[model samples]
Target chain A: MDKQHYVLQAKGVDISVNSAQGRLPLVHDLHLDLKPGKVLGLVGESGSGKTITCMALLQLLNPKTIQIGGSIQLNGRELNGLKPKEMRNVLGKEIGYIMQNPMNAFTPVYTIGSQFVETIRAHTPLTKKQAIELAVSSMAAMDLQEPEKLMRMYPFQLSGGMLQRVMIAISMCLRPSVLIADEPTTALDVTSQMQVLSELDRLRKECGTSILLISHDLGVISALADDVAVMQKGRIVEKAEAFQLFDQPQHPYTKKLLQARPMLPMEYEREKLVI
Target chain B: MNLLEVVGVTHTYGSFRSFRRKEKAATALSDISLSIGEGMCLGLLGTSGAGKSTLGKVILGVEKPTKGTVLFQGQDLYTMGAAARKHFRRDLQVVFQDSFSSVNPRMTAEKIISEPLENYERLSPSELKRNVAQLLEVVGLHADDMTKYPMQFSGGQLQRINIARAIALKPKMIVLDEPVSSLDMVTQTHILTLLNELKAEYGLSYLFITHDIRAAYSVSDALAVMDKGRVVEMVQDKDEIFSSQQPVVKKLVSSILPEHPRNRTLLNGDVFV
Candidate 1:
């Protein structure tokens, strides 16, 4: 792939939080690239700064206590230093974000339809009717039954799976060039998780959207990510094509991670049956 | 005889919109029957809303099923008198999903582990301290850690402490509800290995409940797949779990992403659109 095909690029990206004593480095000199229409998996344990690194791309961190450094480019345009208003425009238009918890993503008081309208109107010149139409269509595409009825329901009324699908529909309705999903399926069940993964895969093929998927589950990463980056203690320990990283992991942490996962039944049987 | 037997358990949660309104009941578990043999781990696998946790609660005596009985050594758990109930509680202990919330933050590790011992037995201060230290050591934590609060430890360490507390009373059975789900893979493996060791040492049975098939396979001697408030399939042989023809079971088995690249079939599975 050509270098220019990279939809999103980050070089030496660092994040630090102000502590009582002084500034403490949270993420150190992290580099990442997302090719167009491909998924890049950022895998790590808790407190490994995988979430912070992805948050840095969208300027989501609080500027008062958090400091971000280095270059972040989306489509060869500098994003790290963009003005707040300019960044706002870039947020839902050029790049969209799906948060870890669908419950926290929306206001419980508002109907799903209302939130969809507000989000759509904020990013585009669409009227309420048009935005609702777009949302219903998007929900339909996700195989959600009775989109009209679902739009009238509150966030609390929906299950985790339903809310997650709604979140995905709302995020992708605008067809942003890139989508950043932070543990998108962590709160969901296995069946719903598979559905969400398929939805993401479909979005990539249908819309050619680049994805930056952050997850602790290696299984999840394996299913969706075209490329993988293994992170440990705020540092990128290894980065490689997904297949290569899984097959012949170079780093000790990567190897340990692979070994730590419980073997599936088929894989377990292969060992026992062969012997 | 089975160490623990859940016979035709049915649990329903009731919701009343107003004082005048009639209660609307939602069935959480429907006629779920299973058993755990002595020194064996029974894995109850299910997705969310599948009643696995409800079944766990019923077996632990935290929730009383509207129908049926949970028998411990052939005695009905719900019908036990006060004195017998206390003994039963000591015999059956539980470890929840979130270690941080499960443990009291204000108490030190020493107090947490010794709380159960203090409830049933009379121990001198020195004896109590020694027991706490021994429990900590068994869970692979340092004896010095007995003085530290839960906040001072990592998630994995906290989980180990939780295990220490669970094993402190030398319970006959432990109901571990998604015990390793919140922790990382390394921590999960460590905890699973520790549980296996403790089971061997104490001959303890476990009701291991989780949504992850891989975790279940790692620790369980037998596997039971629950779906929509029902136990759809039970496999005494772990190897036969993959060959399960139940649609829900097949979906779950196929849902597991192939760890090795060479064995990839997740992308080709037709379960997902």
Candidate 2:
């Protein structure tokens, strides 16, 4: 495929952290591509460098301690080595980020409305009234109940599911070209997970927003991902379409991961009666 | 014999009065009742804030119930004398969801596992060390790992340490409150399998509390579904749970996404709940 066709492209991306001993490598040479309106699921265990890759993409990692080497392009424009001020404008406008824990994502002292309106106004030229209107609509689009009441309440007042929805609302309001969700549903229950997934599904379908979904749960990944990439210890071991990857995992690590999933007790095991 | 029985238990929070006015008390659990037979695993399934953990606390005697009776081995737990309660303390133990916070960060694995032994039994240093090593092996960890602190180990390994501490006294019953929820998929299966083996080997009874349907069903011989602090449904036979009539039960069962994309249930927004 031509380079211009991809929405986001990372070529030979490398990440390392500096320590007293020496520079320690965290992620080896990596390559990833996110096309327009495609959901690329990145699956890995904890400490597999999935989050680090996402951070590196947006230049969220501190440059002083962590060195990220590679060429990252968003919409045919180079993103690596961009100045702090330039990167600030690109973040949440060109690329959206949703973290695993929604509770810690917001400032506790500020009301949800204040935070949402502030973030929206920062990227776009709009009045407070206009920003509020956009925030309410975006929140409603995410299917959040009582957007006005939720806006008035503090972050601690909402449930985890509601908070996550609000987070998605804030991230998707600008309609960024790429959305990087790092374990978005890991902290939520099953019902809440389905809600978040459906909202994501709607966003990709209606708006054609490409998503870089990072999660450890295969179930969540399989449900939405058009393509899947299996990462192990900072390297991509396998990349295939969702069905092909889940059905016939090529890498041994991917096979072990699929095998390790908790399944319901077999039919025979459920036959025995307990006292 | 029933290892534990909770009858008409109702737990309320913030019932005490403030300086000027009485606080509005919240009923976390109301008239909740269940029984765990000896050597059987009873899974308590619920979403968050459903009063599942509160019930676990009430059964473990961590909190006093507003109105109820907790019978352990035919003795009323709350009404028992101090001497008897202290004696029974060693027989009942607990493992929490966050293994990191459940243990002291400053202590090594050896000290954490040997805490219950130190409290209940009089043992020399060598004997206590031997018992700690044995417990570590039972949980599928090396004896050398006992010297490491909680931070040095992975999340799954630290949870194993928590399990070792719970089973240290060879407790008759364990209240496992979301023990594997924080870990990843692979580690979850490993921990659940380990819990099952330990249960069969020790003939231990478990009050397995969690929001995860697959984890709960894997080890639970019987399952109870809770919604808003009440036991909405109970599956006496674990197999029949797949076809339960309750909306709450069906919702949980559908939450476990199919392994293959061809069986995807979340194609639209309405199928989930």
Candidate 3:
């Protein structure tokens, strides 16, 4: 594949945290590439630096306590060494982020409309009225009920599922080429999880947005990811096409992970029974 | 006689915003009824806000239902005397989801596990230490781990410690509320295996509450589906979950991500292979 086809590319990425004792490397020589309109599933156990890697891409990590080294290219533009003001332009307009907890993603005190309007005005040349119009349209597109009413509600008033949809809507409103979703559906119930997953699927299909999806659940990754990268202790143990990774995983860890997931009765093991 | 029985149980959360305005009561559980035979694992499956946790709480005596009775060995749990309630507590224990918060951070594994024993029995310190060490061994933790605090252990190990504590009292029934949800897949399997072994060795029953279908099917002898605080369907055989026709249950079953890549049906009707 040509290099220009990849929307986001990271090569030799290393992240380390500094403490009183010394510096401890959290992620080592990680490499990832997200193709345009493709979903890259990053799977790992907790504390395996999956979240940290995504944070590194967004330049969200604290510079004083942590060190990030590597080259990250978004649409052929080098992301490293960009000033805060310049980085702001690339953040929401070119690359969007959806955090795991929707509660923390928005200010509890402000109505959803204000935050959406502010975010739009910051990234685009639209006025507040035009930005609110865009926000309403996007919310309606996500199939959220009463888009205008929802905008007036505080974050606390909405259920978890509703809040997550609103978060996704806000992120997609900017129509970024690349979107990084960190455990987006982990907190949701099965029904709500399906809704969010379908919404994400629609986003990819409709907008052709490339996604870097970070989740521990193999089932979720199987449902959405086009490619898979298994991370263990700050390293990618395996990277392959999604089907290939699940069907014929080369790495022992990947195989172990695949086998570890619980399946339906058709896949049940008699030896697993107690009696 | 059934090991445990819940009949016509209803739980409601009264809104306490202010005395000035009356808020409508939110029904957490509505006329729910179920039974678990002795030494049987009954899986309570539901989505969020489906009252799985509330039902578990009612069974564990953490909350009193607005209506109906929970019976243990044919005796009403709510009407029991103080001494009987104490004995009931000894026979029925619970393990919650978050291990870090469930187990005290400052206490060593020994103290945490030996708490129930200390509360009920008059064992000497050495005997208590011996029991703690034995419990640690049962959960596949090293004997030396008795001195270690919660922070010193991983999420999986801490969960093991919590399991050790739940089994400390030699309970006849244990309520496992999403016990392995916070752990990794590998660790989840290990914990499930350990739970099965402990159940067989101790002849214990379990009220396994979880949203994950795979986890529910792994150890449950029977499964119950709950929606909006009601048990909509009960399957005596675990394999029958696939044939369930209830819309809610069907939605949950279909929501399970395919374990094998070949089983996946893409959006375009093409097989993943």
Candidate 4:
């Protein structure tokens, strides 16, 4: 592999959470590298600090609550010591993040059309008309049958799956080099989950956008990732190529996680008696 | 006689600001009837508003049906007076989705488990402690956990504590409303195994309510598929589940992404619902 292909690198990253809840390190000594135009899936249970690593990458972590010490480099640009202005300018243009809940990221007062326009115009000098056109076109590529219909609709009107599609569209409209999606389909139904994830896969394959996919669900990670990282107690327990990790898990934590999958469901009987 | 019976049961949340005026009383549960025998497990599968929950609430006498009856061991559950109904509740219980939320945050695990024994029957403080410890052990939780709060336990561990509390009174049956849906897959398996073991030991019945058809398959001796306010299908044979030729059952069966190796989507779009 060429050195030029490695897009992002992290070394000994640590994140601490401090609130009324008290102070604790959420991510400890985490390290990973992402190649350009490749999908890196991070799998972990709740409170495993996958989201903290993503936040730390863009310097978007809470300053009041979190203390961070580490190094993060994207395309040879050191992210750790960047000034506020430089970090702000680098974030959206270089790294587009799709949060767990897309509704939280969007405003309720405006139509998705207006929101998409604002997102595009904020990053680029494109006018509202041009942004809307680009947004609709990008949304179309995600197999959103009527991007026009979605463009005019409020976030509340669209289903969880459809909103995810729109978010993907907005994320891609700027042509950001790296995209981070955190549990994008956990809120969706099975069919909708497959749909949005497939679309995300298609986007990465076609557009060459390096993806950092973070989810607790191994099934979702297995479907999309070229590389896999398993986290436990704020640490990466295992990291390998997706096939290698799934096929031959080196860590005991990974084995425990695999056994935890719903291979045997006996509750169907309970449903009948209880209801 | 069945342990629980429903005859043409209909539940209506009698109208709203505009809803009542626009439509006749919305029948949340329509002409629903099912019999669950002693120690029999019945699965009710449906979406969020599929009247599955309404059936559970009615069975527990939390909600009264607009039509028909819910019979507990051939006695009408709704017709009883308040005091009698309160007394009747000793034989019934509910385990909701969230274990931590189901448990009072302030109460220790010991307090949580002991309340049922005291409420249902008179017990000395020492006897209550003994019973609580036994209940905790039965549910596979250690006696040492009695001193801990619900927040200290993981989701799976919290669920074990909830189960301990539910079984404290040794109710004839429990209405489990998506108990394991909020839990991880591994935790779900452990809980399922525990429930099965307890049912056999206590000769208990379970009314298991969930939307996931695959999850339902494991614990069900018999199952009912509910759609919109009605049970569209019920599995009679214990051996064959998902082997049904019925179109609606097939759709429900296929929608579940099981470990079985097969392309489930025989026909798309309409089958997903």
**What lDDT does the true structure give each of the candidates?**
0.89, 0.90, 0.90, 0.79
Best model number under DockQ = 2
Interface RMSD of 1: 2.3
What TM-score would each prediction reach against the true structure?
Answer: 0.95, 0.96, 0.95, 0.83
On TM-score, the stronger of 2 and 3 is 2
Ranking by lDDT: 2, 3, 1, 4
Q: Give model 3's DockQ, 2 decimals.
A: 0.57
Question: TM-score of chain B, per candidate?
Answer: 0.95, 0.95, 0.95, 0.90
Error of 4 at B215 (Å): 2.8
lDDT of 4 by residue, B149-232 (tens): 988989988988888878887788888888777665556778888988998999888999987664666677788877779888
**For residues A174-221, what per-residue lDDT tens digits would candidate 4 score against the true structure?**
888899898887666555676777677777767888999998777677
lDDT of 1 by residue, B50-111 (tens): 99999988998889899999999899999989999999999999999999999999999999
Candidate 3 — which residues are off by over 4 angstroms? A267-275, B15-23, B269-273
Better of 1 and 2 by TM-score: 2
lDDT preference between candidates 2 and 3, better one: 2
Task: List per-candidate RMSD values in Å.
Answer: 2.7, 3.6, 3.1, 5.9
Q: Which pairs of residues collide in model 3?
A: none
At residue B147, give the lDDT of candidate 1: 92
